[model samples]
Target: MKTDKTIRTHIVFSIAIVASALLEPCANASSIVGTKHDLSSYTNSSGQICIACHTPHNAQADQLVPLWNHAATTTQFTLYSSVTAKSVPGQPTGYSKACLSCHDGTLALDSFGGKTPAGAGKISGANNLGTDLSDDHPVSFTYDTNLATAHPGIVSPASAAFVDTAKTVPLFNGKLECSSCHDAHDNQNTFFLRKSNAGSALCLSCHNK
Candidate 1:
């Protein structure tokens, strides 16, 4: 029979092994597990990192949707406006609205899968975009050839159907949305920028200047 000390040592080793298994996935930078988007740390029931944002089935139906897991905020944002701007920006729609579910700072980060105010708290500091968006880059606006032709600052999509010849920067049905610039699942670039903005390369991708 194992002595008391031997039994205690075995239990300690087993617990350490289990803990490592739970954490190793989060250490990998290749996926959402290790990124700032990873909310598995605060969740209690599921170890899945994607569960905070997406669900395979039975997702919220009404808003922030297309199988989105989070509850939508009712905040009517102050969109970017300008007298000289040719693009007629509208209230957040599609993916931009989905992103605002957390970024607008009116909703908690863990309020997902029908769990309102999961006690994980809201995003704060630089990550929080707040309700006022007049100072930010405009989103949820049509970025078609007509708008491109009207504004010297905007670049026309090379293929007309996509933002670039490479189609890396996507337009949702010709509308520029937040996912046009950011990818939530991947963050290899800083702040989840779809591509590096070093020397303003990413900005220049869509902007004429």
Candidate 2:
């Protein structure tokens, strides 16, 4: 027969085992790495996901893209503007341009790794954002306190509430871009949003409304 102390130790060990199992990382099926973003359809492929967007060596030296394997978009976009919008947006830069390289639907999805396939693959369906961005949310815009002051609905990116919070909207070089609202690598949230927008939680993080 076990003593009371032995019974307690057994219970504690069982609880620890359960807790570790619960803490283990589960497979994310919706993540971009293995989803449709994985360019396995193209010829001369090694079946590597990161190869679609990145290479270990001989990457473009001039672009800001990290080890970029794909060609950057040259299409000029019609930016979003509104009478109430305080921020002045420029041409898409940084990750926004990287995202548009395929999303703009002008370039082939398989046109990467310093090779352009014949009749190269292209983005279709609702995912295609195209070059005309007048309807989409404005990107590549500085989102500093000045803009927040000009537009009372927005919270400053520098504020402690946003930066220090667990649910934070990311900015690129003090600017709001496509990656700000979306996380291409993780899709635990719908639409690859960095956090759940349920009840407008993500929107309210940046917008006071």
TM-score of each: 0.80, 0.81
| Reference-based TM-score, model 2 | 0.81
Q: Give the residue spans of candidate 2 off by over 4 A.
A: 1-26, 29-33, 43-45, 165-167
| Model 2 per-residue lDDT tens digits across residues 53-77 | 8888988664657898887888999
Provide the lDDT at 10 for model 2.
Answer: 100
State in Å the error of residue 94, model 1: 1.2
For residues 82-161, what per-residue lDDT tens digits would candidate 1 score against the true structure? 89898888999878989988898888888877787654588788888999989899999988878878888777775453
